[model samples]
Target: MKALISTGGQGPDFEKVKDIFTHVNLVVAADSGLNRLVEWGIEPDFLVGDGDSIDTENVATKKYSYNPAPRDKDFSDTELAIIKCLEKGADEIILIGGGEGRLDHTLSNVGMVKKYAQISLWMTSKEIITILSPGNFITHHLPQTQLSIFPLDDHSGPVKTRGLVWELEHIDLNQSMSLSNRCVDSEINWEITQGRFLLLATYE
Candidate 1:
């Protein structure tokens, strides 16, 4: 089954989550995100986090809770939610409502990508997807949208990109060599030959 994971930040676009839930079998809320889910009148199946951000009593009466300690040995709230969903047999995760708050939390949410190699989708209404890995990936884009690719690891190898306005031919992308190219058509493709890369595809 697929799972939709929400973070403990400002809520995501209702339409975005609505579109995703149609394909997923489960919904998970990370901390205060449970309140956002309730505010939107959407029911989540699981709640995983430290419980400091939301009322455990509310979660208990409405959904299954997996509360961890504030000083837990591992995993952020988003990470915990993703882990819980995976434990429940979810093969895919759709993460939303993750980037609208603090910079540290936003960075932490992105860091969660390095931990999971499975198929995952992240959206914030404004940004359609921001993915990571060392494999070929293709996504549709509206004309004029921008797609940026940067090596996630230090001194990564060459990354080949196709179907973009400024295509790269096995060009090395690093902290300084990240590529931000505009989409030329409805489709864009990329292949990472070396280290992990973050593909931030978005439209303004």
Candidate 2:
């Protein structure tokens, strides 16, 4: 199943986000994310959070399955929402409203993508962020879109790419050697022999 988890970060453009809702199998809210949905006049299928940031009076009128976690739990509300998606057999998880928040929370959400790299995980705002594991992957983007790649592991070995302003071939990418490149073609291909990397594509 494809699941979309909305977090309590910066609010998203409802017009743009509405399109994504049509494509996903399920929609989940993480605490104040319910507030965002409420603003958009949409109710999520599952609400997973501590209920601390949500407006109780407003949420009480909404009809949805609520899974409340302890406020003092180890996992954040967003993380708990992700677990709920997994429990519901989600193979592809997309996170919305994940950027432009507390720096720590934003960073934690990015880290979550790495932790769940075995599955197809992504986070988006004005840009889409994905962690590419060791494999061959292809991406399609408009020409001149900002595409940046960073090594998630200590070293990404034998990485190869095509259709970018700055292409690579069997290059060892480390933390200090991030690629702030741009897409040059409608289709871009990438392959990594070892280690994981993060790809960020900014929307124009």
Candidate 3:
């Protein structure tokens, strides 16, 4: 199933979430993420967090499953939510509403690419990041949207891209990045020969 994992923090507008809401099979909230979902009139299927930023009384009226952890746990709320999503047999996971306030937190959130292959996309209010495996990939966007794509690890294989202002063909992704390219076609495409790379598209 496609699980939509919402983590605490700001910058995940309703439009971004709504764009894929119909494709999502489940919604799991982490910590204050419940409040974000509630603001959008969305009731998540499960809630997991350290109970630091959430309101217990508000959750008591809900019927979804709740898994609370101690404030001193090793895992972050987003990690806990991911584990819960895995437990629910989610084959595909999309993370949204992650915090970019703290540099460390944002780094950890983006670094999740090294750990979870099930997570394919991250949609925030300002940016959209996608993980492309060894295959063909394509997505639509507004005209002239800026994009940057590269491998998190410096070991990705050759990649080819199309529909950008500056196109690429079979270039080593680790050695070169297609940075600051605008999607003039209102669509982007990529073909990966092997390994994984991240494609980041900024809305603002």
Q: Each prediction's Cα lDDT score? A: 0.73, 0.79, 0.82
TM-score of each: 0.83, 0.88, 0.88
Q: What is the C-alpha lDDT profile of model 2 across 1-204, one tens digit per residue?
A: 899888887755776567778888988899988888888887799998999999887578979978678899999998898888999989888887777868998788767876775335454566777677778889888889888887777666777989988887744576445456888898889888888877887768
RMSD per prediction, one decimal? 2.7, 2.1, 2.1
What is the lDDT for 133 in model 1? 62
Deviation in Å, model 2, residue 166 alpha carbon? 1.3
lDDT of 1 by residue, 59-118 (tens): 667746565557565778888888888899988888877666689987787677666755
Candidate 1 residue pairs in clash (backbone atoms < 3 Å):
none
Q: Flag the better candidate by lDDT, 1 or 2.
A: 2
lDDT of 1 at 62: 78
- Residue range 23-57, candidate 3, lDDT tens digits: 98889998888888877888898888877888766
| Model 2 misplaced stretches (Cα beyond 4 Å) | 118-121, 177-179
Off by over 4 Å in 3: 170-172
What candidate 1 gets wrong by more than 4 Å, as runs, is 55-63, 66-73, 135-137, 177-180
